[model samples]
Target: MKKLLILLLLPLSLFASLNIAVTYPYIGALTKEIGGEHVDVEVLAKGNWDPHFVVPRPSLITKVRNADALIMNGAQLEIGWLPPLIRRAGNNKVTPNASSFLNLAQHIELINKPNSVDRSGGDIHPDGNPHFHLNPANVITLAEVIKDFLTKLDASNSEIYNTNLLSFKEKWEKKLLEWQTKMESKKGLKVIQFHDNLAYFNKAYGLNNLATIEPLPGIPPSSKHTIELIKLIKEQKPCCILHDVYHSTKTAEFIQEKTGIKIILMPHDISALDSIEDLTSLFDYLTGAMQ
Candidate 1:
């Protein structure tokens, strides 16, 4: 009877999956891709919402409380909302100091580090721009980081994680080549944006970001800024306004009426739009949007 009981419990231990809580849809997607059958991912935020502003809800607390590990975009992207969730959940495993906690920003070299900290700058990220994942090359780096993180946490399935990482890297490298070829002709294309969220993407594809609709980050468009932008647009003659889906297009539309510039809605993460179902589709839409 004792031998039969031991045999029954052995498979359960081998097949158990780690429940990982990720702060955003993209992280959740990446974790699932690498974790495969060995991990269960719980995404805390919706992709369509602004990554800077998430409403910490009771349900998110429960998810964090139950997670075996937690992953975040870091670099202060979640500064507004995530800290509250972590405090409320009281999950040591998900705390920043814990071994189970993973801050993706720590692994990647962040860009746009501010020279000084001030609320007058309109919600600047002290560490840097947290949207490093927008660059496809950084995506590969993130995959490697996640692979090592998983291996460290669950050595029992290290081989499986390694295999998954290799497969992802091979496929992504091919996609990178394809994206580069598609964007080759669009190099040095001048464009406007509602916000500077696409800094990494523009840098990756060599798109020149002329200016933003807003006067500053996290600030709304003003009539003074709008008139100035109109003048700049007529002078600079940018291709279009690459607007984010969450913000209202009223300002961009007004600019279009005055300047006859185009407006293109850009999705920042997986499921950010209905068409963006996964990582591949997200980039596919983004790279194809110029046409």
Candidate 2:
């Protein structure tokens, strides 16, 4: 009877799932879409907040402690927030060099890398721009990487992960075509932004970003810089100012009043607003915002 019980339990052990942790809502969504029933995702940051300034609260430490694996956007995007949580989690599986820890930045090519690194540059990523996910094409690449990571951590569910990926790819590609069609006419249009957070998005759609409101990355706006921006906007005649949801629009508004330009609120992640609840909605709102 004892021997029979052990044999019966063996199959259940083989099919056990993993508990995964992700740094951002977008990563959490992709992991769920790829891992399907084989994984549970714990997202650490709120979607509406600034990605650069995620508060590493105590609760996040507990989430990391209990996770079987961790995936992050990397490229130093998490440098300001995630390290402390990982150190406090005391989970070896989520360590930087562990097989269970996956960094998505390594799998894709990063743009906007600086020739030199310094604090004077204002919160620059030494590796390149960390916001690569803003590009719809990069989202497909990230999904594939997540699928492989899940399979490696739980080989028994490899087939399930693969199947889920195929379905996701089919749906995502169709969405990409829709977005591409919508953005086709907006090419070469000039715009201003609070920060260069949408660097990848601008590149993908052939939109020319004339300048940013911030004097430098992570630096607050200065009166001198704002005055210069007013002059530039008057001379260049950009269509509008693409402002992010997190930062106060006071500066952008001032520019708008001076130049008679429009200010469009762009959400950077899922739930950045009530309407943007998923990856599709995030891009949909973005592509449609310019219009």
Candidate 3:
């Protein structure tokens, strides 16, 4: 009896579940959906934290130190410090380059790939757009990639991952169809936004993308551009001028006053809004607001 008890305890200690770490809460939710009880999922960035300037706390290093895999959006979005964090964690099992690194952009159709990048002014991604997570369609595309990655990493639990994939796919597809129906009923739906962050949602919901408050991506709003943008918005008469949670509301307020278009606040990143702290809530609240 003593030998059997000791043997059982040894297995539990030696065969603990895999430690999986995701870069953001949204990704953590997805991992949990698939991983269920088989894997331990930890999110490095909270749902409300800025994904770019997140300082990896000492505890984060410890978490990553024990993880089996590390996942991130990774289209240079994390170029600032993730590489160093992975190194400091000193975990051979969770090294950014060697371990199971799931860079999500690999599966989606990338855009805004500049022929040449010279960031003389500010941050830029020459590799292509890294904001693939903004669109619901891209969500499906990336889901397939994630499922494959999980299966490859833990082949022993491939069936569980597949089961989660099937369930998630059905629910997401149903919601997509419902959202499309709601958007299709509206005619000539016009919108002006601070940034092109809504490109994916606009496409998914059939919302008209008239123009942006910001003249270009990465460029701040200038008085001259704002004047022109207000004029354009006045001419088009859009229903709202969408401003992301992180964007300066000064431009949005100016446009709203000059053009009388409604100011709509949105969360481009999952962490940016209260109701949209996770993927499902993000879509639900956004679609409801749009409708």
Each candidate's number of clashing pairs is: 0, 0, 1
Task: Write down the lDDT that model 3 would get.
Answer: 0.76
When sorted by lDDT, best at the front, the candidate numbers are: 1, 2, 3
How would you encode candidate 3's per-residue C-alpha lDDT over 1-291 as one tens digit per residue?
999999989978655766788887767777777777777898887655545557878988888887888888887777766777798988776665664878876677777677777777454455676767767767777777778888888887899899998898898889878766766765468888877767667766667888877666566888888888878887878889777776568878877777778988877656678667578778777777776
Give lDDT tens digits, candidate 1, residues 38-155.
9999999999999889999999999999999999999888999999999999999999999999999999888777677677767556677788898998999999999999999999
List lDDT for all candidates, in order: 0.92, 0.92, 0.76
User: What's the TM for model 1?
Assistant: 0.96
Clashing pairs in 3: 47-271
Task: Quote the lDDT for 103 in model 1.
Answer: 95
lDDT of 2 by residue, 1-291 (tens): 999999999888867768999999999999999997778899999899998888989999999999999999999889988999999999999999999999999998999887777866675567888999999999999999999998888887889899999999999999999999999999999999998889999999999999899976778999999999999999999999998899999999988889999999999999989999899999999999977
